[model samples]
Target: MIQLLFILLMIQIAFILILSFANPLRKLVVKGLDLLKQGRGPLVTKTVAATMCVVLSSTVYTITKIQKRSKDAGIVNPTDEVLMARRLLEAAFLGFSLFLGLVIDRQHYYIREINLLRKNMETAKKTKSQRLLKEMSGN
Candidate 1:
């Protein structure tokens, strides 16, 4: 499970890096994201995120319970110590994955907005130039 979460976190980080730059690949990535958000894509993504959140909460609960047990016993068993450490690592990875996912989503959204603005600006410039040409010719 930790390995899986680590892989997911790495993928998210890579996606964020890809989205941070203006390059040919960035356009492809943005297009892919656009398609991913269509139809059932959003529902699946939200479901997965919600499931991860639940698992994270459960891990936290387990960690707290382990700590309480150790406190009550006045000593931490070696096995409990190892288990707590593992759980903490898992929680950290899960949290980072979720955060990076949100960052990637936002980056994709902004990139799309920037692209739209560029298109609108180009269109406006063309129209303005056309108007200037008509006025000059008429005069």
Candidate 2:
């Protein structure tokens, strides 16, 4: 179980590192998560992140207390496995938070791009129509 947790932690770290410098991957991740944001995306993502933060802090505190109690009782390595598991859980949550942030950033980028395009298209069409009307009236 510890080995499995270690492997997962490593994978999460690798993913985060890749996401940091990989623009294409970031776009893909954002597009993939776009469906999730069709409604209340930011709100839901923020809520989840806040909830995870609370859970993570509480879990860490509980784990530390357990470890301390075990140490006082002269237990050896009893908390070692639990600690590894906790670390894995923490890493997973952190990775998720990072992904959510990226998703929000990408969503905003796309929204802005789309709005700019629409504005430009409307301007172009309106100008072309006005020019055509002016030419017809002058003739």
Q: What are the RMSD figures for all models against the true structure? A: 0.7, 6.6
Cα shift from native, residue 32, model 2 (Å):
23
lDDT comparing candidate 2 with the true structure: 0.65
* Backbone clash total, candidate 1: 0
Q: Judge candidate 2 at residue 32 and give its lDDT.
A: 51
* Collision pairs in model 2: none
Residue 20 shift from truth in candidate 1, angstroms: 0.2
lDDT (10s digit) by residue, model 2, range 4-108: 545645665654554456466765654555666678876897796786677667767766776676778786574576775666576566556556556556655
